[model samples]
Structures are given as C-alpha cells and as structure tokens.
Target chain A: MTIATFPPEPKPDPGWSRYFGFCTDAKVIGIQYIVTAFFFFLIGGLLAMVIRGELITPASDLVDRAVYNGIYTMHGTIMLFLFIFPVLNGLNNLLIPTMIGAPDMAFPRLNAVAFWLVPIFGSLLIASFFVPGGPAYSGWWSYPPVSIQNPLGHFVNGQGLWITAVALSGVSSIMGALNFVTTILRMRAPGMTITRMPVFCWTALAAQSLQLIGLPALTGGAIMLLMDLSFGTSFYRPEGGGDPVLYQHFFWFYSHPAVYVIILPVFGIFSELFPVYSRKPLFGYLYVALASFIIVGLGLIVWVHHMFPSGVAQWMRNLFMVFTMLIAVPTGVKVFAWLGTIWGGKLQLTTPMLFCLGGLFNFVFAGITGIMLATVPVDIHVSNTYFVVGHFHYVIYGAAVMGIFAAIYHWFPKFIGRMPYEGLGKLHCLLTFVGANLNFLPMHPLGLMGMPRRVSSYDPEFTFWNVVASLGAFLLGVSIIPFLLNMVSAWIRGPKATHNPWRAIGLEWLLPSPPPEDNFGEEVPTVISRPYGYGTGLPLVEHQDEIERRLDLQEASAA
Target chain B: MTDTTLTPGSVEAHGQHSGHNLTGFIIFLCSESVVFLAFFSGYALLKTSALDWLPPGVEGLEWRTPLVNTVVLVSSSGTIYLAEQFKARDNMALFRGFWLLSMAMGAYFLYGQAVEWSGLQFGFTSGTFGGTFYLLTGFHGLHVATGILLMGLMLIKSFIPGNYSGGEQGVQATSLFWHFVDVIWIILFLLIYVWQ
Candidate 1:
C-alpha cells in the first residue's frame, strides 16, 4: 500500500498487506470483502458437510437434534449474510470505481464503515456459538413464537445475538447500497452515460436499490423481534396476543426480494464475462441492463411466494405466482442474451469462461425449478422438502458462488498482477461443476420422494440419494482446497501478467495489473466509449503496442 | 443523459461533491421511512389480528401534550429554514440564534413526549396497543434526538473560524432530516393520537 512501490516488484507478490485494518481504498476493501467472505464460506461449507454426514444415515448419529439445528441454522445465516452477499458487495466496491473510472467510491469513509461492520457484527453472530445456548438453533428466517423467548436457543442469548447480528449486517448492506448507488450515480467518468456504463454497474445499482428498499423491513422486523425477546414485549409471543404470522410477512418481504439482490451482481458479472471471452459485444445490451430493473420490480412482489405454505391467502399466493412466473421472462432474456453473446465468436474457454458457462447451466436449472416451485400446487408439495433446498442452492450456491469464482479468476491477474495457476484453476472449476451437480441435482428427486428438510434424521428409504448428495457435497468441499492453493500460490509466485490480460474493454483493465493505489495518478480517466466496445471495428489496441507506445512516450504514470 | 459536451481522453470534472451529499441523504431518508413503514406495517398486522386493537383495560391517549409537541416540532422546521436563510444572507448572529431556537424547540418536543409517556397508564408490556405506541414513538424520538445532536455539532461548528459560509450542506442535510422527522411525527400523530 506504500505509494512509493512504483513499478511494484515483478514476481514475489503476495499483496496481502493492503487488507489490514481501516484501509479505505475500494480495492483494498474489495479484497477484504473477498477474504473475509471466503473465510466464512469455508465455515458454512463445513457446516454443510456436517449436515451431509448426518443425512448420510437414517439416524441422527452425527449430532443431537439441538446441535444439528444449531449447525444448519448457522450454515444458512453465515452463508447468506456473511459470505455471498458481502463477497458480491466486495466485488462491487472494488471494481465499480475502476470500471466507471472514478478515483474512488463516492463515500470512501462510509465504504470502509460498511466493510468494517461485517467483522464486528459477523463475529457477533459467530459469537452465538460459544455462548451457553450453543448458537441460534432456530432456522435462519427465525419466525417468531419459536424465535421468541425460550424457544430453542433463547435461554442462552444466542437468538438475541443472531437477531442483532442480522440487523447489523442489514445496516451494513444498506450503507453499502447507498455508497455504491451514489458512486455509480455521481462518479461515472466523463462520457459514460447510464446506458454506456458497464453492465456490472447497472446490476450493482439494481441490486443496491433492492438492498436499500428491502433491507429495512428485515432490520426493523428484527429490531421489533429484539424488543420482544429482550424487553418483555409481546410482539411475537402468542400468549400475549401477538400474531406470529406478521413477522413472517415482514421477513419474507425483505428476504424474498433479497434472493435477487444476492444474484443480480453475479448476473452482472456474467454480463461482463460473456463479451470478453466470446470476443463479441453483449447482445441486446440495453435489454440486459433493463432486465435487471425488471427483475428488481418483479422480485419485490414475488416474495409472497415464499409465504405460500405459511398460511398466506390463496389470492396472495396466486398473485405472487403470476409475478414469479413473469420474472422468468426477463431472466430468460438474459440467458438468451448470453447465448447470443457466445454464439459464433472465437471462444476462449479460459477458467473464467468455463465457470461462466457452468454457472449458466446451474442458473437455468435453478430458474426452471423456481418457476415450478411458484405453482401453488407444486410449491405446497415441495414446500419444506429437499426439493426447495435443491432449488435455492442451485440459484445461490450454484449460480452465485460460481459467478464469484469466475469473477475472481477473471480479475485475479488485475488484482494480483499475475495469472492464476491455470491447471489448478481449471481443476477447481471441474470439481466444482461436477460436485455441484452431483450435490444438488439428486435432491430434486429426493425432495419429490418426500424427504423433508432441516431434519437431523430420516427414514431409511431416502438414505441412498442423501448419501449421493453428501458424496457430492464432500467433493464440493474438497474442490476448495485446489482453489485456495491456486489463489495463494498464484498471488505469491505465478507468472506475471500484462495489463488487460483478458483484452477486455472496461476502464479498469486499461491500467497495469494491480492498479496503482490511486488508480489514475495526477489525472482521472475519461471514458470515451462504452465498456462493451468489443469485437468488430472497435478500437481494440494490442497490449504490446500500448506498452511499447507508452514506454516511448514516458506516460506510464505509476506502478 | 447527454454526453455531447464532453472531453474524452483527459481528466474530467468531478460534479460537485456537495451536490451528491443531498442525494445520498435523501436516499438514507428513504430507507429510514422504510423502517417506519415496516414497524407501522407490523403494528397494523398485529393490531388487526388481535380481537381488540385497544387492550380492554387501556384508555385512549390524552391528545393535548402530543398536539403541543406537534406544533413545537412543526414550528422548529420553520426556525431551521429561517436559520438557513440567515446563513445564506451571511447573517451569522441571527443564523446562530434561529439554529439555537430550533434546537430548543426540538428539546421541548422531546420533553413533551416524556411527559406524555409518564401520563400513560400502561407499560410497553400492556399489550399490542401499548407496545406499538411506545415503539413507534420511541423510534421517532430517537430520530429527533439524532437530528438535534447533528444540529448541536453544526451550531458549535458555526462558532469556529470558518464554517457554513457558502457550502452549508451539513446544515441543509440536517434540516432535511429534521423535516423528515417532523413529517413522520405528523403521520404518527394522526395515526396514534388524532384517530384515537
């Protein structure tokens, strides 16, 4: 992080010090987000393995019901709040400024505040495990009555801590939303119109907008629940005239919209990945961006689809069913647009591209299952079954995690100034792809076979499929070792990369690998064309020519 | 929307950072409003579900203190606007005077809330009605307190060698939040007191 490290060292470069406390650079914050979220991802993944181990048998042999409840509870909460959401946010904070060619995020200090809140509050949530109650055994949604006083983990303060942690994370997310939205709105480089901005920014803006609007409901509901739990209020206690369903409505209102909020950024990443790898401009660019907003609009109303089995009215479920089905249209447009992007160009099946293709495979399946689950009859049948588990994991774990991996692989050179070990990278992707399918694909039938979810033990009849899924999950867990070794070894001693390793047109790639601390020194960049100035007749300069030409001109400003 | 009047290859002008503060502040308020909306929504849900919205033993709230508090709060908005005007005119003495007056009014409104709470016959545990009332009003009161504290900082900063001479985004931001608080209180007043 020393500005003096101009022409920063060529090889021996594990640039890890930039992630130390209170650093306000969006790039550093981005790495912090990645590292922190990835740490949590490992923990959540381990919990899943524990779950898989228990489900391997018909008996609850791995842990007691209470402990198993604690395991899956933390699994869902940690994965959603601590890992996927923050990683996407980290990517946004890191890249959006450079992608838009801004000097920094609009609110640099606030951005740091948002990043720092995660550790404080994240630790708070994790702290629930060490307490006497042994972590919040209530499910992640924590519907009240059960989520209220003395329900499961209530006596030991873990439930209250979980609620507080979630509220804090919600606050952190909302603040990031504000920072990113403002940065995009006010910070785009000259000539980068909204339509011309990178599609990633559009998705980020769309996601941030959803976070801004949807998160408060969860935060407020949590606070209200907090009051009930701690302050002797009857907000959710039924004996005192509290209606538990109200909490459900509030929770779903935010949590459902948040499902798209989770994926939209990764969707944006795909928008970036498709063009650069395919050597083609994003097909239907405007529609791809517009579809995110359409998804946002549709995502808000379809939350009640989650409430279908929870005693919502028939009219409400039908209304949500229609809206939920409508979401498939825009989502389909995005999927086809990707297909159109990769149709006939000279394809580069690099690690990032491979992951993108694999993610799309998972996302399409997820979307199809989601639509199936939207149908009132189908949803009621599969409501709390392994099918529902399969559906969401396909979307979140399959789509979003794959996108995170792809974005990391694609941008690794840009961040670490070197290429990742390609063999190892490809191995990680292969194992992940196979492991994910083996893990989640079978759960559809298992769900259809009437295996209820969140159960520590089940009938022996369902053991085979559960064992299969567990084997796949173990494979998925194993997949991360190669990813970690590749990332670590690559950042330390991998081959050096030229600027613009992907030959992408985004403004960020124009700078050297591992862009300078201030990105553009002395002068902020001006965007002359859209980021998708890709393929035919676009001014695609060879990195060699630009490097040589710049050497002669002495215009390379910083390391 | 227009990129026509632009430079392409060199440094671009940063749109005034102050211009964006207001936009960001307004966005923050939108979220704050959502928070209230969630609470009011929950209150509505809980109220409607209960066989009696008002607990059997609880009487209606006495309206007079809240009404006076409302007037005090609404008037403080005026005082803050006047303070802004005076600042715009560079009338330092009057600017500080009105700003202080606005803070005083906010304090009075909060004091009114305390008196009204003391007069109420029920605790927050008294059932749905009592809980909702205290929660909404208490959260709103926190916002009011936060607004005043921000103003207090601004008021103190105004005495320093140089502050709010031309760019008073801080004062304006505070004023915007203050008004949001006032507006929410008005709605809260109508729902909690007037309707009752």
Candidate 2:
C-alpha cells in the first residue's frame, strides 16, 4: 500500500509509476523509515513521561507495579528498536546512495524486504503490552536468572514475542548491512577510493562491519534462549546445568557493540555536518577514520564490561576493564577532532550545528560516567541501580537521539524540497537539551543514594528529585511540538530549496531536491570531489559543470 | 561527475580480474561463516555442560562412506570449474555434460549423508551432540540441494537457443552460488569430521 507521499517534483518521470509497488526509489524508502520511526519515537516518549509521572510520587499510585513494568519495557523497547536505530538507518537509506552516486541500494529487492520486516517485528513487540500479564519486566538488558524467572507469568508469551521480534529485526539489519557493505565496496563510482569517500560513508562502512561480525552471536543466543523456554533445553537455566553467564556472553557480544552501531553513524553525520558548517576541512580526517575502525576493534573485546559483576575470572574482568577504558581513547580522539574542526573556523550556528555541538556535550558526560562504570569496584556498587540507568540514557538520549534530530533538520531540504521553520528548530533544540539532562542527570545521584531502578515508586526522600525529573519529562514532550509543527508547516508553505541550499560538497547535492527516479539523468556518473571539499570554492572536476549544464538544458527543453 | 570514466566491466579484454568474483565470494563466505560460527559458539558454550559424551542411541559411522563422499564433493568443485571453462569456450555440449555431472556428484554427496544419518541411532532432536551434528551437516546438505537445483537450472538454460548467452547474469549468479557451496563444504568437513 502507498504509505506516504512527497510533493510533486520539477523532473517527474513516467517510469516512477511502474515502480510504485517496487518502492525502489531510495527517497521513498527513506521517508517510509523516517515517518514510521517518528511515530514510534512519539510512542516511546509518552511511555517515558508515564514512567516519570509514576516516579513523581513516593508511592506507586499512578499505576500498578505490573503496569509500570510494561511502561518501561515499551519505553526502552520502542526507543532502542523502533526509534533511534531505525532513524539512523532511514537516514542512511535516503542519503547514502545519493552520496555515493549509486541509483539505489545494490540489492533493491533486499532493501525493500528489510524495510518491510521492521513494522512487522515492531508491532509484535508492542502487541505484547496488551497481553494478560503486561510486557517483559526484566529491564531492557533482559539479563538472565532475573530475566528467566516469570513470577509475573509475563515471561512466557510477552518475552518470547520480544525475543522473536528482536531476532526478526536482527535479520533485517544484517541484510541491510550486507547490501551497504557490498554497495560501498563494489559499486562506488570510479575514483571514489575508500579514503576519498565521505566521512559518513566511512563510518557507515565501519558500522555495518560491526553488524556483520556482531549480530550473529545475538541471533544464536536468542535461539538458545528460545529453546530453553519452549523446549526443555537449559541453555541459560542454571538448574538445568546451563550457565546463565553463557547467555550474558552471547547477548553482550552483540548488544554492547550495538551501542557503537547506534552512535558511530551519528558521529559520521556530525563529521559531515561540522566540516560543511565550519567552512573548513574536518581536522585530522585520517585520524577520525582510523578512530572509527579502532572503535570497531575495541567494541568487540569490551562486551565483558557488562559482565563485571557476574564473577568471571578476575584477570578476565581486569582485561575487559582495561580494554573498555581503552575504547575511550579512540572516542576521545573523535571528540577532540570535532572540537578542533569548530575551533578557529567560521562556525555557522545553524540549527543542525547547535544539535551537533549539544550532542558532543551530552556525550562527554555519558562517556565519563561510562568510565566510572568501567571500573570493577564502582560497577559492583552501582550495578543495577539508577546509576546504570542514568549512564545509558545519557548515551542513548543525549548522544544518539540528538544526532538523529540534527540529521533531520540538516537534511530536510534535500528530502522534502523545502526549508523547515528555523525559529521553531532553535526552540526545540534548547528545550530538548534542558529537558533531557534534567530528566536523566539526577538519576545518577538517585542511584548513588542507593535507590534501586525499575521500581514504580520509591521512599519519600527520593520524591523531590522524582518530581523534578517528571517536570522535565513534560518539557521534553513540549519540545517535539515545534519539530512536528515546523516539519508540517514546511511541507505546506515553505520556500522550495535550491539544489544545494547548504552548498555542501557531496554527490547528493549534485542532484535536484528530492532526487530523480533514475537518480542521474542520461548517465549517473561517478563523483570526483571529496565530500568535505568545501571553501576551496573550486569544482573538484568538470563533472559538476556538465551536470549543471544538463539540468539547465532539461529545464529549457521542458519550458 | 568527472571525465575519467572507468568501464564497469573490463573483463572482456583482460579476461577477468577474478578479484571481483573473489571479493564477492569472500563477503558471502564471511556471512555464511558467521552462521556456522554461531552454531559452533553454541557448541563451545555447552561443551562443559553437555549431559553425556556420546549422543543418545548414536552409533559410529563406517568412516569409509564419509571418506568417499568427501572425495566426491571435492571433485565436483573441479567439475563445476570445468563446466565454466566449457561455457567460456562456447561448447554447449561439454558445458552441459560437466554441469550435469557436478549436480550428480552433489546428489551422491547428499545420498551419502542420508545413509550416514540413518546409521546414527540418534535423530536431530536427541541431544547436544545429535542436535549440533544434524544442524551442521543438515544445513550443509540443504545448501548442496540448493546448489544442485541451481546447476540444473543453469544447464537447461544453456541449451535454450537465443537465451542470454556467455557470461550472462544467470550464469554468473549460479557460478557464485556453486563456489559458495564448495567453500562451506570445506569448512563443514573440517569442523564436523576432520577437526576431531
């Protein structure tokens, strides 16, 4: 079925109608991802507000413990699976082909299949909430022993559905990753060498490589867990002689690196944005690229950081601790390089740039607190507390979520052929910034004060900050209003954007707003300039001149 | 959009880079490797915790039949390569003969696996050893069955006059899959039979 539509274009092709069922147009597929993901983002946001509301009082009065369990499960489930990750992939689907000068994904049918599976899996997980016992209550991590016990009996059906849905999504991601890796490697236009490609493309490459190597462990682990629940297998049952710790080994082997999979592309987006807005080349471009790869390498070994309290071999714990800390080394280099890029350059404080800078600030706190959690002694004290909650949300909300908003504001013109309301964007950015930190930052201290997490309510002493956090969640809800309004208003009445409104140096800008059915006219040629070749004010090669001439000729002919 | 346009496929003049096929093959192999790696990972995780050493009701295979099947599977890889050579030389008859022979060899390998499975007193759902052994070889056999079907399709398509000829997309797809099956068999033989 036709899901959504963009406004008609200057260069409409008759061929597009034939491909309607196909949805081979990358922009259409990308829009499908964005709209679907945005809906889930709203649902997930409401779940969080409910959670904050319940925590506003000392008693679990707003909802019962079971309902609170479902609310938080849906919140984490929707945000992680349905919102943040999909937004990133949606952005990549829309933009990567244009950036690399390909017409669409290397495997078009596979791309369509990947997008289609998302909603199916997403719905199955959400459907679990309405079941008899509510959704999975084992927290988002769904750790074993605690996760395995279903005193709530919510365990069997709801959690089983959750695992299956996640596995389905895992397959979708793997297919997408394979297509991205092949297209980037095999189908890049001649001379678009790996180094000469856009920084975002490089990071996408690294992210997919992580997916390639990391996801199967999770899929296998899920199957084993399923076998345990459905069959009599003891894959994770200690009573059945299955070590619950083994499940941890398999889960984090994929899940921990999945954190990088979420943030690295966000880093890639910022990498592309900083250079364009700064009117300078990204500082230490090689180092940033290397840092992405190094993070991938470090991402693999640090899965055990999640296993610190599990009583693994002591030296093994120390080894994981050291590697976990070392991961920050590359991450720190990225933060420095971003700061350096913006330092002396003519920085344009566009809405997108503000979000990028804001992400950096939030990520710094996230990373430092992460370092705190990395130490074994600190982990034992803070493990499973609100402290852990505060740490992850900082990374997920402060880092990945802001990165998504930055991309949306930055790329809206290219996607929709119009500029969103600039004033509304700034307000959204500021309010979102304040609300998120106020909501999550106090969680750290609450955790430090020995307040356990995931409970519906707490002691009267914790009530004050809980109220404050709930107020911030309301403000967080308000922030999205401007974003939605700006987008809808821009669709109706905003001025149509020029081919390169931002004058960014990338192959995507070489085409019209909401690019054509074939992507390139007559011949979709390879790009020669580096994506960051801005401020040189020289066309990297004559191909852009030819494209400009062709566009002019086509316009004149139509006239 | 530069004037330095490289031809998309320069294989005609310089024969073939083998690198393109090799790279694509490597990527496919890596993905398949991860699936098997996942299964092996399950085995490793459960090794210490397995209920018993031998699978329930399983008996030893004769070893002679497995040795024969392994040799036959390896030899089919060569015969498939020969089929490709004949196709490149436009010898339709030779290509079809070798192609059909390779499919026959694959069938022989599958038949051998069936006999071996029958010999084992345990079935796939028996226990860890039974489950791992069946899943590993069973998955490989499925791949072999798929490969044989692909080969049969390719052989039939080759003789259909005025059908897309000589290094067409269909042929390339089939060849890629054949080589993939070959590589997986090598790994399965090592992990299941040879490694122990």
Candidate 3:
C-alpha cells in the first residue's frame, strides 16, 4: 500500500481544492487538461452523432443544411483543438518530468499559463455556436473565397470568433511546445542519455518541435484572414488581385505538419505501451526515435499534396506526390518496429494492451489507405469524397483516440491509484474497435462509388451504406458512456493498486501511485540503467542505502 | 552558496538548464521565421498574380523615411550589443544607458514609420499591393514595438543592483529579437521599396 521512503522525510500535501484553479504543479495541470478536454470531446462526439443521424435517411430531416455545416465544423474544431492536441499536451506535462527523472517541467509557471489559455480560447470557440449566424460553416479548414467573400464568412461573427479562438490556441500550443522542448533537452537525469530516455519523450520532442516551428505559419495566415475579413484587406480576394490558393498554401504549411503533431506523441505512447505489455526491451528503439524526426522533417514538405486539385502546376503536383510517398518509408520503420517488439515476446492482453493492438490495427490500415490517397491519380478521384473522410477518421479517431485511451488506461493507476475494472474496460475497447470500423469502413466503398462528402443529403443509391455507417456512429456514441462510467467509478470505488501495478520499469514506477507534491519525494531520482529493462538481469528496484546510511549518520552525530 | 542566488553570472551557472537558453531563443526565432515567411510568401503570391506590384493609380511610395528608419533600427542592435558589453564588464550605469538609448532608437524608428504611413497614398483596403504592404510592415512594426517593450524591461531590470552585472540572458534575448526585426525590415525594404 506504501512505497519505501528513501529517508522517511515527509512533505506537506496540497489540499484537494488546489486543483480547482490555477496551480503550477504539472500533475494538477495535466488532470485539468484531461478533464476539460474530455468535456469538449463529449460535446464533439455528440455533434458527430447528430451528423450521423442527419445522414440516416438521405434527407435533410434532422437539421437544416446550413446548421449541418455548423455541426461538422464545430465537431472537427472541438475534437482537434480542444480534445486531441490538448490531451496529449496534458500528458506531456504530467509525465515528461517523471519519465526523465526531473522534479518538474523546466518552466512550471509557463506550463500553467499555457493551460489557462486553453479554456479562455475554447470558450470563445464554443460560444460561436450560439450566435445568430451559427459557427463557422465553411468547414474547419475555412479556406478563403468560401470562407472569405461569402456573407457567412465575410460578415458573420461565427467565422471571426473561430479565427480568434484558433489563433489563441496557437499561442497556447507555442508555449507548451517550447516548455516540452526545453525540458526534454535540458532536464534529463544526469545518467539518462537521450539514447536511454523513453521513446515517449523522444516523440514528444519531435511533436512539440513541429508545433512550435510549424504552428506560427497558421497563425500568420489566420491574421491575414482576419485582416481580409474585418479590416478591408484582400489577402485572399481574387477581385482585389489576391490569390486564394496562396492562402491554402500557408494553411497547409502548418496543418500538413500538424498531422505529425497529432500522431507522433500518440506513436510515442505506442512505443511505451508495447514494451511494457509484451515484456521485452523495445526492438529497434533507436530506429523508432529516428523515424519521428524523419517524419517531422518529411511531413513539412507534403502539405502541397492537399493543394493539388486547386490550380497547382503539374510539376508541383508530382513533387508533392513523391514527398508524400517518401514519408511512408519512415512510417513503415515504426510499424515494423512495433511488430518486431511484439513478435516473439510474451503478450499481455490487458485492456491497455488491447487498446494498443487496436490502435495498431487502425494505424496500419490508415497508413496504407493514406499512401493510397497520397498517390496523385487516386487522390484526384477521391479528393472530396467519402474515401478521404473514412481515411481521416481511421487515422484521427481510430489511431490517435485509441492510443490516447491506451495511455489513459495504462496510467490510470498512476493518476487515480486504482486499476480500471477489466470487464468493463474490455467491453469499452470492443465497442470502440467494432464501432469505429463499422462507422468509417463503409465510407471507403461509398467514396470510390462517387459519394461526395459534407452533404446532409445524398443520392438514394448511397442510403444503405449511409444507414449502416450511421448505426456504427451511434454505436460509437454509445460506447463512450461505458468508458465514462468505468473511469469515474474506477477512480472513486475500484480496488486499490500497489505502486508498481503493472510491474513496469520506468522512473515513474519508482515512486508511489499518484506520487507526492514533488514527485520522487525525499530525494531526486537518478537513473543508472536502461529505461526498458524487461526480461533482463537488471534489478527493477534501486536501493539508495548510501543515502539512507548518510541520513542516519547525520542523525547519530546530532545525538 | 545556494543556487537561487540572483547574481547575473552565478544565475547562468546555477540552473540545471543553460540559463542563456540560447536553444530556446533560436527555436523561437525559427517559429518567427515561419511567420515572416508566410507573410513574404503571401506578398510574392500577390505580386506575381497581380497586374502591377503597386495598385493602379497608387504611385510614389516614400523610400527615404523607411531607409533612414532601417539604419536607425540596425544601429539600435549595435547599441544593445554595447549594453551587453557594458554589463559584462559589470558597469551598471553604461549598461542601463545604452539599453535606454537602444529603446529610444526603436521608438524613433516607429515614429518614422508612422510618418511614412500617414504620407502613403493608399490604405490597407486599396488593393492587393496596399494590403500586402500594410500587413507586412504592420507586423514588422508590431515586432519592433514588442522589442522596445522587452528592451525597456531589460533596462529597468538592469538597474536592480546586480541583475545584469554579468551574462544577462534577458538583455541578450531582447538583442536577438531586435536584430531579427531589423533583418526582416531590410528584406522588406528591399522587396517593397526597391526593384519593380
């Protein structure tokens, strides 16, 4: 029930209410991020169910067409800006210091400042939904011309609020990225070399690097868009001799790299989970780390692929296609590494591990389809179709969300000091895995069959598959209820777990569950062995007898 | 001998991190580069796509004021460098004086920019040319304003007994930012004021 105290020095505990407001502790901030992000995720998910409901009978029965646009736009905005990125960043804040054997993030106050920006901007974004014109209905990307000259975009408050909200989130992301980069690079334990650090930190470094470097491009574009909208600028207006496609260029420059921003951290979590569950030292660990850097570099160049259909020259199109395909090489290295890590080792099929495998299934499937969509010929056919939609969901929801859940379930004991109920956890995983596939899978065939996306009503011929897809989405919606119940109940009433619940070998496990005010109480931890030492002769627990003996010596001398 | 000692040289030597945070500063510079790159790319796109680099009937953009302001801004970077040197020698008065001078130069440049803006024939809404012109210069001016603010803070902090007696990281960061603004302005002057 208790971890061994190195010197038995007790520290003051922060009371429960410290979590309700601004607290500089990374653990508190991390929990704040997850709880707030989950609230947003529920909102986004509910909007998704509405989207599916509207698609059920191929008629605009449930909501008006314009309102439907607002639904999907808000859904994408919330799930992305509020849910995925922030949740991952929250984890980064919580786990980075503990994993690297540091007492806290390099800049703890800045970390708190970064998180506080989220709710302020997220409220601005969500509040856009209630205004007279509804939220920005030009889609989440909000490309100009449709996003600019049209009255909904030009004169409305919704688009303006959306732009401001996203820009604020951009500010938040920049701060968090800088904090992560500095902490990972400068604050590693003295004995822990970069090579010996966990894969999660490496991937976090890659992801946060891309964010700080890439997100400003989007911020600049948004400012230009704002000027065009409110201040009589023509940055994207063709009548004023500004090129619309150029805005797409600037937008994709940030957003295309943003795909890696979303995935690299999730992929990092994958690296951590597989080694723990499979009971093996990670195979090809260096390659896995190198692959993230490669992905970050390669991901930046392929933003042009999204601009292919819109007046890009033939040469540019081919260039982007090649770069997009080339990115698959580094990505392939990661997939193989995951497979090799689990190939001959013992596999623990716990819920967290099950979610990891589930996420892997989606990742591989999405990666292949992604490469298919990357091809110029195939993309020209399916650019605005359901195939693109399906492919995106498989990667975003299937991979990123699944990996997040895997991390959540795996680290629940560390956060809540209890294991999630296994039966319900498995059931939640099954429903999600089955529901996700059923929901997104049919869209592929429908896309190839020429079903255009973003339509509230479609051809009668598409109704059958659309109905089935709607059912899958509903199932996905229902799936989260059990997950929520499981988490809440498990946190409050589940059986207690020991400090090293999973027998994992990491600096995090060296401390008590839910840790102390400062993690690794009494003394700072220093690493002496490799991070993942499974199935090896290295002792999992370290003894600090010298330090303990010194403490006694000081006490004896005082006596 | 506690590490939290606020003496400038000791502060840099004390932290677990590189107190100069040169890497963080450089990374921030990269992000700022991307932002400015976006503006530059926008301008390029608009210029190539337009009938004229300047809008129809909009002629005679002033060059002398911006050129003079560019020199003034660039010289402020020199002044900040002088401040850094003065502080490194543990000369507090000269450090504070040169930093204040650097900020005054930045303020003078901003005033010059305003005078030039008042004389411009076209507004932001005039056309693509005017829009790009105003956006680029406006963003640059904002950076200069921020640089001035940061330098002012550094100057005030320098007077706090021993905060900048040696290896002042805040002052160095402000210098980097000011120099970055100056460099961006040079590029802008070359693009928008010179050539066709």
lDDT of 3 by residue, B107-181 (tens): 999999998889878998988888888889998999999998988787767668766545577877888888899
* Two-chain DockQ for each candidate model: 0.45, 0.22, 0.41
lDDT of 1 at A28: 89
Better of 1 and 2 by lDDT: 1
* Deviating ranges (above 4 Å) for candidate 2: A1-9, A13-21, A130-134, A145-156, A522-529, A543-559, B1-26, B49-52, B55-68, B118-127, B162-164, B168-196
Report the candidate with higher DockQ, 1 versus 2: 1
- The deviation in Å at residue A358 for candidate 3 is 0.7
* Candidate 1 per-residue C-alpha lDDT over A1-559 given as tens digits, one digit per residue, 9 for 90 to 100: 1112223333443355758878888988998999999999988999999999999899989899999998999999999999988899889977998887677888889999999999998899888889876888889999888777564434449898999899999989988999999989987766567888888999999999999999999888898898888888888777888878888878988999898888898989999999999999999999999999999999988888888888888898899899999999999999999999999978999999999999999999999898899999999998899999999999998998999899999999987778998899899999999999999998999999999999998989998898899999999999999999999999889987777778788777766677777675434444445567676655422232343344223334432
Candidate 2 vs 3: which has more DockQ: 3
lDDT of 3 by residue, A1-559 (tens): 1123443443455667977888988889999999889989999999999999999997889999999999999998999999998899888988898887666777788889999999999999988888778788888899898777446443548988899999999999998898889888877655577888899999999999899878999999999898888777888888887888888987898888888999998999999999999999888989999899999989889998997789899999999999999999999999999999899989999999999999999999999999999898899999999999999999999999999999999988986667789999999999999999999999999999999989999989999999889999999998998899999999889876565678787878765566665675325544567767889857532343343343445345434
Q: Which stretches of candidate 3 lie over 4 Å from their true place?
A: A1-13, A150-156, A539-559, B1-14, B17-23, B165-167
Q: Which run of 10 residues does model 1 chain A get worst, by summed lDDT? A: A1-10
Ranking of models by TM-score? 1, 3, 2
- Using lDDT, rank the candidates from best to worst: 1, 3, 2
Cα lDDT tens digits for candidate 2, A31-139: 7788888989999998988898888889989988878887887788788888877777788888787777666777777788888888889999888877766677776
C-alpha positional error of residue A239 in candidate 2 after TM-score superposition, expressed in Å: 3.5
